[model samples]
Target: MNEDSTPQSSTEPARPSSGWDRELLEKLLLEALVEQRKARRWSLAFRVFLVAAIGLGFILAFKPLAQGGLTAPSKAHTAVVDVIGTIAEGGEIDADTIIEGLREAAEAKGVKGIVLRMNTPGGSPVQSAYVYDEIRRIKKEHPALPIYAVVSDLCASGGYYIASATDRIFVNPASIVGSIGVIMNGFGFVGTLEKLGVERRVMTAGDHKAILDPFGPVDPAEKQHVQQLLNAVHQQFIAAVKAGRGDRLKDRPEIFSGLVWTGAEGIELGLVDAVGELHQVAETVIGAKEIVNYSHRETLLDRVIRQLGTSVETALTKLATSSPRL
Candidate 1:
């Protein structure tokens, strides 16, 4: 062999040993690992930043979306409390509900003034009187807070009784105002029971226990007593109106003679302070440009719950009313 030829092995390069190959592979793998770690950190930071931004967005949107209807300004800090339907027992305008609504409105920090929006044809004297007393109490407690009553469709009898408690009363030009009186209505079923040969055996220790029973003949004395009571209630209503209206009331007995008047005539007769819509009254007269609804709001869930409760109560009432005599 030639001396120089000893230096040449093969044309192809020799394969590296396992250890050497592993070291080279490990070095490259470590470099790749370092790059992956850096990429992961950047990814984590970006994800965290995105999450924080989304969280902030949710926090900002939460209030407006949650309380959209309630938070929106109606141009006044005034709250509207609606008094609709009958004011009697089992009626929509019950004393408890009215008092609760008024109490909430009175206590609400956001509520600056109260607008009693009345639309009723009257109801039980007791129920009306209870609401009236509550209004008076709220007024006495929050003397600085102004309470304005706006008669919508009708504010007659018991409804007017409630409106009398407000600082000012405004009625729409077409609204029906006043019916200063008292009334009691019942059907006499004694003749029908007699015709049907249905004997109503009512045994009681007290002579007047069943005095007003519709199934029995009405006693003349009992009728007279009831009439006297009704008269007394009417006089009380008259006196309350007179006291509330003061000299604003045109001194006329016809005003309290169970006569309902139109909003225009009511203004002339001093049954109402002025004739205007609720918005106009709030904006122009009261100087409260913004309106907040202090009325009791029943959500769908609340309504469902209330309906269930009402059903249960009705069932109980039916059971009680249909029960046999004691």
Candidate 2:
């Protein structure tokens, strides 16, 4: 080696033997952490899948028991179709579902009679009319199969409208059983908006399109037009009640004045045929002690969704204008 050229020192530090082992341990720990995360995710997914599967199985198991037409009881039985909520489209007590249950009960084997188990505060007039017409049709088709309305807590307005179509209306003495009229209600926020210095702007294709706007002043012409519409619907309601009840209903003006009445009062007014419970009616009236439910069963999720939708709709209706209801 030349005297002037000294040996060059290593620029890099000499790595310790433990450094490689430390890196390997760190890599292994990271891999273990990744595996743990993946495992936890899979476990959560499995739990969710298991819950969903159990729910599906539960629904499948109960569907046949709820809907009884396909597999009705062998012995004599009275079929019960529930009308136990607001009568509106897409509701638990909608016309389509009720009609389906009615048809099923009529077609079921060894069905002595069919009963409309009513407990509702009323809802859509159109929904009520659909059920009423269907009941009449079913009565015509199965004249021998006596159909009755058995009132529970309440059967008012649209509920009464449907009950009128039945062969007889039975109720407990304290049961509320009448409200044979139509109603349309809304708010008038014009004054409030004006006071608040807020202006409402609306665009409509026709002059009368916004006649029912909550933020608009009520025009006399529009009010009269709305009154005429209400009167027309009211007349239709009256006609249906007359046709169904015939001479059964008393000639009382208040009977059709949107007034609610107790079961006892309803009986006196010729609105209810008798005061009785479900079992009593089934045993004594239909003479079929064995009762089978034929109502559509809504799952918990379905009921939750439906109730949420109804709450939203009700809120919206309150904010805006409501259509005529019975």
Evaluated with lDDT, which candidate comes out highest? 2
- The CA lDDT at 255 in model 2 is 92
Runs of candidate 1 with Cα error greater than 4 angstroms are 1-76, 110-112, 297-299, 303-326
In order of appearance, the predictions have TM-scores of 0.67, 0.73
lDDT of 1: 0.78
Error of 2 at 170 (Å): 0.5
**Residue 252 of candidate 1: its Cα lDDT?**
86
Please, what are the lDDT tens digits per residue for candidate 2 over residues 215-299?
A: 9988999999999998998898889999999999999999999999999989999999999889999999999998898887566
Can you tell me which runs of candidate 2 are displaced by over 4 Å? Answer: 1-62, 65-70, 300-326
Error of 2 at 237 (Å): 1.0
All-Cα superposition RMSD per candidate: 19.1, 11.2
Deviation in Å, model 2, residue 294 alpha carbon: 0.3
Residue pairs in candidate 2 whose N, alpha carbon or C atoms collide under 3 angstroms: none
Q: What local lDDT score does residue 326 receive in model 1, on the 0 to 100 scale?
A: 17
Number of backbone collisions per candidate: 4, 0
- Model 2, global lDDT: 0.86
